[model samples]
Target: MSWEEMLTTVQESLITYWDGLVGSLPKLGAALFLIFLTWGAVTLARAFIRKLGSKTRMRKNLTDVLSMLAGTGLWLMGTLIALAIVFPSITPGKALTTLGLGSVAIGFAFKDTFENFLAGILILLREPFAIGDHVECDDIEGQIEEITIRDTHVRQTDGQLVVVPNHLLFQNPVTVRTNRDLRRTTIICGVAYGENVDDARSVIEAAVREVDSVRNDVKDVQVFAQEFAASSINFEVTWWTGSQPLDIRTSRDQVVAAVKRALDDAGIEIPFPYRTLTFNEPIPVREQGAQDEAA
Candidate 1:
């Protein structure tokens, strides 16, 4: 109960704690060394996975996922081993139980993140699209720059980078524009109603096929009489071309120009909108110069 008795007890307790700490130094050192080795092993595992993935027909994103999982497994095992070495009382069972509970808590906290991750995994597995492929999903049209575990980086045609959650792409309808080497493009070219339908069709088809970008050889150019407009008869000119935005645009420009030139040479008029406005009252109109002079 006295101060001296309390002081002696505290000193003895400190001495025992110091001795225990000194005795456990070797264990701590061993655990640190094991952790260092584990880091090296994880690095090697990732390098090996990447090499194998490249050699095989696996997707790059799937390769990334596999490497990540391998690293995670290695780190988990190493951590358990290190903890057991540092503290002899701790067992693998206890460590795994604690990890499971922590993981549950983390999963609850990051529900959306896990959803995207799972969606990304499915996307990588399904191989619906690939990096550098042009895709459109829910108004986001772009080339797939990268596919990560939680988000996909889309570089839009306008050069804007959009980070979209993988879940949205997985859940929504995605249009892969570059799914094949060739894409079908249709343009309705209208000629004057007085023009010969058969002659106009032949002219348009020949012109479209002549275009540099049009893949008319692989797929025949089709010029069908789609409908009769108020001013002209519309022909739906369809053909195959390169499967890229720029390629499509270039083909369209060339096709339009070639068709116009051919139609002009063939004496076929590409009619403009013919509007006849009916009014209850007629108003006098004057030329611009006359109106200005009158004003």
Candidate 2:
């Protein structure tokens, strides 16, 4: 084609497209207004949901998930409505068909993301553990700080923060330490072999009971001679205490100190490892002068 003919064709196409855009301006404006309206509605709904959650006994994580799902659903509906207004032929069915066709590629590209998202949803629904619960999952043990759509945030005992993927938590065994009000803790105390077993047991039981954090209501404090060790007899002392990790640690510390002092006061020996060596055969003794002559 000649240059003048090509220029004329391009000019005609531009004019036609400009006229079409001008005709659709009102629909475009309505679509934008609808989207903004949906956004405002979503915000209000979220606030209302949060307010309702606070009034009820529902978990914070569940409330957050519910709010997110509600907002996403509303946005999706608004987007479809806007699209249909802009292009009357594009219906929800058609949009879904288009998504279905492209879903395989999208799924492959974002497999882990979707997996975590689904897992997070399941976890929130199950209510296995909540924020501030002390949980040990796989190799991670910490207090749950936050639960998100993709990951969970944990604050470890050492003050380190860990972001754990939700899929791992869902798949693995999780130990929720704070699920109950009380937890049982045990300590092994060894008394010298010469000490009276009954007396040592009594002393340990008393000492553990004296600890302020130890739960005394249940009569769960127990002391039993477990086994004979290499150096001393071991007493297995079990007691109930608060379920928190700090509670267990503090109670244990107090129990240990109290037991040590009580035993020392009672003159009940807590012995160190004692060993004696004996030769199987007698050896001849040689004087220093005799060794020098032999050399």
Candidate 3:
């Protein structure tokens, strides 16, 4: 209970604190070093995969997928190594068990995204349609611009790019318009009831032939008397053109314009709808009565 006793107690406490700090220095340094190495390795792995992706012969979507998958795998491996080095007691088996148990919860939370991811993989592997192919899925129609693990990129005919989930692509019917080398178009024209059907057919066929953008791969340039329409005789002009959907649209416009000019030159009157209105008589307005005003 004196000054010397107090001094002795303070010395003992300082010695214990210093020993504890010295003992913990190695563990702290090891953890820090492992974390730094893991970060550097992950960065390097992504850079390498990005370079590889650029050189790949795969489609743009597939290339992106490969790069992402490779980068993720390398980062995961680096994380596992770093964790094991820093905390040796945490075994890989325990980590796997924990992740497996947690996956069930995560699966439900990300069900839609996971389905989209799986669907994207199927689309890429099956090669249903490649980039630049025009596809109609559900009510959306556009050209395939890019594919991803979760979504598909499309450039619409109107020059807009849309991002659609892959699940939607798989769940709905996809119509690819430009798969074949040629595309056929049907253009119907109506002429007066008494016009020469054979002569009109010949004129229409010649008009179709004059279109330079039209393809010759069609079975035949047929002008059929399809129907006796309400006002005139319907002549069907069917032809083919090997062009992209946008180009097909332009080509169709050209063909239609040419056919219209030819029909005008041939004196074929394309009549409009007719309606007749009949009136019995006009109703006369009655003058107001003075007696009614009084009431």
TM-score for all models, in order of appearance: 0.81, 0.81, 0.67
**Model 1 lDDT vs. the true structure?**
0.92
Model 2 over residues 168-273: C-alpha lDDT tens digits?
Answer: 9999999999999899999999999888998988888888888888898875698889999999999888999989999999999999999999999999999999
Question: What C-alpha lDDT do the candidate models reach, one value each?
Answer: 0.92, 0.93, 0.81
lDDT of 1 at 206: 81
Model 1 alpha-carbon drift over 4 Å, by segment? 22-33, 54-64, 85-89, 121-127, 274-295
Q: Give the clashing pairs for model 1.
A: none
Candidate 1, 5: how far from true, in Å? 1.5
Worst 10-residue lDDT window, candidate 3: 77-86
Residue-wise C-alpha lDDT for candidate 1, range 1-295, written one tens digit per residue: 9999999999999999999999999999999999999999999999999999999978877999989989999999999999999988899889999889999999999999999999998898788999999999998999999998899999998999999999999999999999999998889889988889999999888888788898877888888999988988998988889999999998888999999999999988999899888999998887999988998
Candidate 3: stretches off by over 4 Å? 1-56, 77-91, 125-127, 159-161, 217-219, 267-295
Predicted candidate 1: what Cα RMSD to the true structure? 5.5
Candidate 3's C-alpha lDDT?
Answer: 0.81
TM-score pick, better of 1 and 3: 1
Return whichever of 1 and 3 wins on lDDT: 1
Clashing pairs in 3: none
